[model samples]
Target: MTAELGGRIREARIARGLSLRAMAAEADISPSLLSQVETGKVQPSVSTLWAIVTCLGLSIDEVLGHSPASREPLRVEHPNPIQRARDAPEIVVENGVTWRGLAVMDPNVDAVLVTYAPGAASSPDDTHMRHPGTEYGYLIRGELTLKIDFETYLIRAGDSFCFSSSRPHLFRNDTDAVAEGVWFVAGRAGAASARSAPGPVRDAVDALDAMSRLPRRVGG
Candidate 1:
């Protein structure tokens, strides 16, 4: 339960891109409390934790990491479905590469776990799709080269990068091994903002369409 609470708080903070101090201030709690909550050092009362979760705009189940009982994450399954991996459709991109979107959301951001094969490169997305918010990525394994606005960044396992979503960027895997990473896209929050900003929407659509046209390969 303590581990669960910590995971929930940490996940919420990361998903919302909030610093501990920032979230603490928003929830009218101290940074110490937030840290404790994230580390499972000090369990927060139900009301206190609820308040924090509310400030972060996450549902209880999302925080708790609970799926339906029957569908709980399998530890030692009798017969796992390898077909699920074989059947998961890949969203093809550039250089004979493909991405299996782990998560897709139309609201404020789009995030995915991407695996890149050797010689793979990303297609350029529209700059107009770029916006005020930022994109964050963490390399889970292997090596990759990220080119953002003409600058190349080499990232490896345990490395992370955060930058504006508006940059004309591409990722390439030049190594012999496969590269796996997570991408989190920050999106607009309010309906009024969306209504007022058709430029971003157009850019995002164009960017995604362009990406879809690139060469792609699949990984499970």
Candidate 2:
């Protein structure tokens, strides 16, 4: 599996027209180091892997090959009597932020349940960045400092937020508490969510997204 992962990484890098040296430069590492990584001669730390993947504009799920089920028939994750943690797949960011999802499809939308350890962040810093879509977030527990378009907003448990992904957005949890949240992003690939989400939850989410745009709304 490890070798396969490395092979996929190398394939993705080449498919993007990046040479080993070019990719090394892009990932801010030496060509020798990147070559070792590609050949699985060395195992990259989570942060190093993250830098390589994001630098190539690929999501961890894509790099790890977790976007297949998403392309299959729509799946309804019905409410279970108990929310048992599945050995289901996940994508880790710096080994601190864990994103568990069935798939991370960029075309339809990328929805994930994310958990952050204390002091963890969506990225290293408040770097200005944006996805090609809209974003909706609901904090399940703890608190977070969400920065959008350079403005920081304190979001706590039960708080939700929605905004155009066109603006730069960043997230971090400075509090000494584990934070968990649900994020829904859409608009680039296709209107898949509109067709996949089941009835009540779908309607409720849409309503919430609409209300989030209103002044002083809780969803905002």
Candidate 3:
């Protein structure tokens, strides 16, 4: 249970886009100690836990309140297959990428079915962004490109991939045809502020600070 508590804190920190160092500084704890606590090497005092919770701007009560991950029963259902509809709640995050959420909402992850118009990219301008936890996607009926840091991958229909959300990553549809995919991101809802870069991979405060130092173009 102690280890579970530590892992919960770490997950929340990751989801908040906070690295061990930044969280430690804010919590007035040493980074090494925090790392040890997160790895279950050492137990934290109640005060220490409170400080961490305060710095992360989230509560661990949900994670500690239940052991659902182990004992919770999974729901089984066969709904008339989900179909994309014109009136469905959809958001165009960029010129080419449209997201429509799925019906299922789990505590550990969020689901979205996405449609990509030609030349659509989750990361516009070729800039990378990070998030918390992990990401999984399956190409349902089109081709899409995945970029993690500097590496690029081509995903076609029926192909699925998962990766750490902490790494700078994005998706693009550069083909002539529209593409569709089912996407899942492992993190609690509103895990990070909208202004923050989207991902669950690493310390986001540091990434944002670094981005601020880059020279700005007068106009794109």
Candidate 4:
């Protein structure tokens, strides 16, 4: 998955006629780091990936291989609302964060079951990510640390929270146990109820799509 993701990112960079150095500069990252990320030698943090995607003008869905061209249009009539556990698509990101799509066909929203392993965090370097949207989450198990700007809150099981994505927030699991939750992100990238999926899903799908093209590792 890492290799495949790197290849796709490299492909997108080339397709846009941007040099590695230029792209790295645009993304506020070092050229060597970008090169490592593109070659699969490094696993980029969520914030780093977000920066790259935003710089390349590529949606996350496109990265995940869930592009509009790859999926049939969702039909209002006879909609299949059931997403079986076996059929749900899941992806692992930087650190030990995992996201399983709960409503994969929804284009205007991203609803996923998220899990954070012990010590796992949304960003590797404690950086926050700010985007245009709103986030609603319900913690299902364990504990999570939510940091918004300079404020920090400890979220416990059964506790829910809502915040604007533009607040530069980050999530982390500081306990020994895994933290799980249901997360919904809406209005990302100003995406509306259109035929195409919203930005967050599209973005996540893009990352997952790259993973689908690669061979699974032992115990991955």
Candidate 5:
């Protein structure tokens, strides 16, 4: 699955005529790290994956093998509202975080059950992720540390929080026990928002072209 994901990212970058360095720069990552991610030599953290997809103008669904056309068939074939646990798509990101999708075809919002193993973190580096959206999360078990910009809050089980995703934030499990939670994200830049919105394709192409033209940074 990791290799396949890498292949999809690589294909999308090439399709947009973006160099490895250019895409990495746009994603605010090192070119060597991006190359490793593209080759499946390493798996990216949740934040890194989100950044890469946003830079490539590709939806997380597409990267996860759920294209828009492919999703149509699912809606037509099964109109059931309840999703079976066995059928839920689960993605394990870098560190020890896991995401399980709750809905099959919801375009306006992304609902997922997230699990963070002991010592898990949303990002490997100090940089946090900021996107155009709002995030609501409820901690179901254990403890989690939520860092928003310069502030940090310790969240315990039964605690629920809502915040704008545009603020740089990171989630971490500092305790020895695992942390589990359900998160709902909605906005113009959520997981599926870019693909559902009109003109994203063109905008992505233009952005890629513009970024590709910039000279590579020294020692970057």
Candidate 6:
């Protein structure tokens, strides 16, 4: 962790093309302290590190080099109870979907596990609110309809799509059973709740993928 922190600090500093002295001044810390951190002679306190990260135009997680998790699926240990959508209780969005969420590199990006129930025609919910973020999804199983703007793509398993959140979109469960897929939502925290315990890397990735399916403009 310390090594990752050091590397992140170094990367941030270099990206800004700022010398240690400059960074120290911008971060309101002593140059000696910066040098010590760079040399791995000392680790900065959380507050100090956050200040440095903010001054360097980086996120708190990025500076710490402790992203939510990797963007790869893994075995789950002590999995939490699945939360089914209130509107689609019979649809069972969680377990029946055969999908998983995982962590990714960006905090603003959420990975999701989207399982579409058969005959579950997706409806755009852009009324009263607008979903704000970019969206992208990849089919993991079965077939489904991906609505973007006014066009619909009959995306099949393994296919992928990306679009802005400003446009309305929805996933229709046009298959005979559940259609499994991954959606990555931008600028939303649909999956990685800071409150949740550290679980499998797959959770993070799945949440990101699910989020990607949300409409950029429509609020769902």
Which of the numbered candidates is closest to the native, going by highest lDDT?
4
CA lDDT of each candidate?
Answer: 0.58, 0.62, 0.62, 0.68, 0.67, 0.56
lDDT of 4 at 43: 87
Which lDDT tens digits does candidate 6 get at residues 1-220?
6666777788878887999888787666899988777767788897567556545545455555556655332322323333334312112233233333443444566565666667654432322111435678888888987666568789888899887553445666666866777678765443222223433323222333344333322112
Residue 192 Cα positional deviation in candidate 4, in Å, after optimal superposition? 13
TM-score for predicted model 3 compared with the true structure? 0.53
Show how many residue pairs clash in every candidate, following the order shown. Answer: 8, 1, 10, 13, 0, 37
* Consecutive 10-residue window with the lowest summed lDDT within model 3: 211-220
Candidate 3 Cα outliers beyond 4 Å, as residue runs: 1-87, 194-220
Residues 1-220 of candidate 3: C-alpha lDDT, one tens digit per residue:
7788779888988998998898897676899989988888888886676567646644345545452233221322335444345423445563556666454424455566878888877765756655445778899987988888779999999999998665667777889999998887665333332233343222222222222222222211
What overall lDDT, based on C-alpha atoms, would model 1 receive against the true structure?
0.58
Better of 2 and 3 by TM-score: 3
C-alpha RMSD of candidate 2: 13.3
lDDT of 2 by residue, 1-220 (tens): 5677788899988897989987787566789988888887888887677667655655556666666444332333443422234633455565267766533323345566878799887655535544345788899999998888658999999999998654556778899999999888765332222222333211222232222222220110
Between 2 and 6, whose lDDT is larger?
Answer: 2
Which consecutive 10 residues in model 1 have the weakest lDDT in total? 188-197
lDDT of 5 at 49: 87
**lDDT value for model 2:** 0.62
In model 4, the worst 10-residue window by lDDT is 211-220
Q: Candidate 1, 77: how far from true, in Å?
A: 27
Per-residue lDDT for 97-124 in model 5, tens only? 7777665343445566888899888766
Number of the candidate with higher TM-score, 4 or 5: 4
Q: Evaluate residue 55 in candidate 4 and report its C-alpha lDDT on the 0 to 100 scale.
A: 62
Cα deviation at 77, candidate 4, in Å, is 7.5
Candidate 6: worst-modelled 10 consecutive residues by lDDT: 87-96
Ranking by lDDT: 4, 5, 3, 2, 1, 6
By TM-score, the candidates rank as 4, 5, 3, 2, 1, 6
